[model samples]
Target: MAILSDITLYPIKSCAGIALREATLTRAGLMTEGIYDREWMVVDADGNYLTQREHPKLALVTPRIKANTLELRAPGMLRLEIPLGLPDPESAPARTVLLWDLSLKAYDCDDLTAAWFTSFLGLPCRLVRFHPEAQNLANMKWTGGVEAPTLFSDGYPVLVIGAESLRDLNERLHKAGRAPLPMNRFRPNLVVDGLGAYEEDYIDTFDFDGAVLKPVKPCPRCPMPSVDQATGTFGPDPLEILQSYRAKPEVDGGICFGMNNILLEGEGQRVHVGQQVGAELAF
Candidate 1:
């Protein structure tokens, strides 16, 4: 039987991820303590989104959920706390940020928060939260016309990767005289065990109790995976190793790893580690 081996919630986009024993599955992604995945993001002064692709050190910005605030810390920086309570949409400072081809309305964080990120990242950037009224939808072409919503994710609402897939890649890496990479390098929201290598690629839907998660698209890998999650630095890139066999013609020959997913049913259901999962094959 396949079981959920890991559940990771990334509160801030492209930053450190918080491992959870259990998490509430939502249409937008995993949520815990009222904080949704990728709810907060760092953006340049021009409102363009910034990620580890440009600054590997962004991974060092770690977040911890306190009672009522999200505490952030980085190397050589003092701890910064952000209130969890939703700010008044009417009164909060707002900005128009560019994420990919979309122009999104986001809540501009306070100067102190902006200063904190700027000092650590060594860039003139500001922190922005997904505005309560903002609606960012995943690609309809990939979703087969189903209107699926996401926050700051690259495209999909959730990313699912099989444990054996990594094991398969690691075995190849070992043969190539390369060190095996950790699951964090891919940063999937859900990790399933007991499946064959790349088995997730053929899965049509995952049933967690009554909740239905539909795999919609292949997640294209980028140089972001080369960034070591622990040290917040660029290490050996595994794309060359992956490109030999993992390239998918469906995504325009982009090297792929995880499967991008969207919730089809039971939005508020809680999924826990070790929970038995039922997967339906596409065939």
Candidate 2:
């Protein structure tokens, strides 16, 4: 039986991920301690989100959950903590933030909080959280017309990959005399074990006992994967290996990694590690 082997939530996009033994699955993505994936983002003056692809230092901005605050720390930088509680709806600073063409209302974090990130990222930027009132949902056409709310994820609510998929890639990498890569390199929200390589790509619906997720899109590979999750340094790209076989001609020859998924049911449901999983193929 396939099982959920790992779950990771990125509180801040392109930064470190928080590994959770169990987390609440929401339409927006995995939620731990009530915080959704990519709930907070760092945006430049143009309101474009920043990522490790261009700013590797962004990975050093580690987040830690405290009793009442989200503590963030960077190398050689002072630690910053922002309150976990929601800001005053009427009094909080509001602004238009763009996450790849989707102009949405976002709460601009406090000046001090923004400065902390600006100093760490070495750029003029501000930290912003998903506006409590803004409605940002995933594209429904790709999701079979089911509208699902999202926080600040790139496009989809969830990304699922199987352990055997990584093993398959590593086996080739070993034969090619290249070092093996970690599963974190793929940055999947869900990692399923006990499945064959590339099994997620054909899975139309992924059922986990009580919850379900529908695979919506082929998660296109990006430079983000080339950046080492541990050191934040860029290195050998998996796309080179994937180009030989993982390229989806239907996707215009783009190499794919994980499968973008959308929540189908079981909101606020707990997804624990080791839970059995069943797959329903699309065709």
Candidate 3:
């Protein structure tokens, strides 16, 4: 039987993720300690989103949930903590930011946090949290007309990948005399074991623990995967290897890896690690 092997939530996009033994499966993605996935983001002075594609070192900024705060730690950097409680939207400094095709409102964090990120990244940057009033929806074209909401994710609410898929890629890398990559390189929200290689690409629905997650879109590959999450450094790129076989004509011949998903039911349900998953294939 297929079961969830790991669940990770990225409080800040392109930075680091928190592994949870159990978390709430919400329409906007995984939620733990009242914080939603990609709930916080680091942006430039122009309010443009920043990611590992441009600043690979962002991967080293690890976050931990402390009592009443979200503590951020990085190599040779001082620890920074932000309050977990939501600030009043009416009083907080609001700014307009752009994430791909969507332009949304967010709360600009304080100068101290901005300076902290700037110091670590060697450039000017500011930290921002999703405004309580912002409403950003995923493209319905891929969701079969279902308007799924997401919080600062590149496109969808969830990204699911099968364990065997990574094993398959690792085997190929090994055959090519390259080192195997870890699951963090893929940055999937859900990792399931006991499925055939690349089977998640055809997943119709994942029914587990009264929750229904529909695989809606194929996740295109990017250079961010080449950036090692632990060292925050770029190394041997795997996209070239993937180009040989993983290219999807449906996505304009882009090399793909995981499946972007949308929540269909059980908005407030808790999903635990090691729980059995009922995977329905498309055909």
Among the numbered candidates, top lDDT falls to 1
Scored by Cα lDDT, where does model 3 land? Answer: 0.94
Considering summed lDDT, which 10 consecutive residues are worst modelled in model 1? 131-140
Error at 185, model 1, angstroms: 0.3
Q: List the residue pairs that clash in candidate 2.
A: none
**C-alpha RMSD of candidate 2:** 1.2
lDDT of each residue in 15-109, candidate 1, tens digit only: 99999999999989999989999999999999999999999999999999999999999999999999999999989999999898889999999
After superposing candidate 3 on the true structure, give the runs of residues whose Cα lies further than 4 Å from its correct spot.
none
Q: Please provide TM-scores, in order, for all candidate models, with all chains considered together.
A: 0.99, 0.96, 0.99
Off by over 4 Å in 2: none
Task: Indicate whether candidate 1 or candidate 3 has the larger lDDT.
Answer: 1
Per candidate, the number of residue pairs that clash is 0, 0, 0
Model 1 pairs whose backbones collide? none
lDDT, candidates in the order shown: 0.94, 0.87, 0.94
Q: Ranking by lDDT, best first?
A: 1, 3, 2
Candidate 2 positional error at 260, Å:
0.6
True-structure lDDT of candidate 1:
0.94
In the range 122-229, model 2's lDDT, one tens digit per residue, is 788998999878888878778778998888888889999989999999999888888999998888999999878998989989988768999888988988878887
Worst 10 residues of 2 by lDDT: 114-123
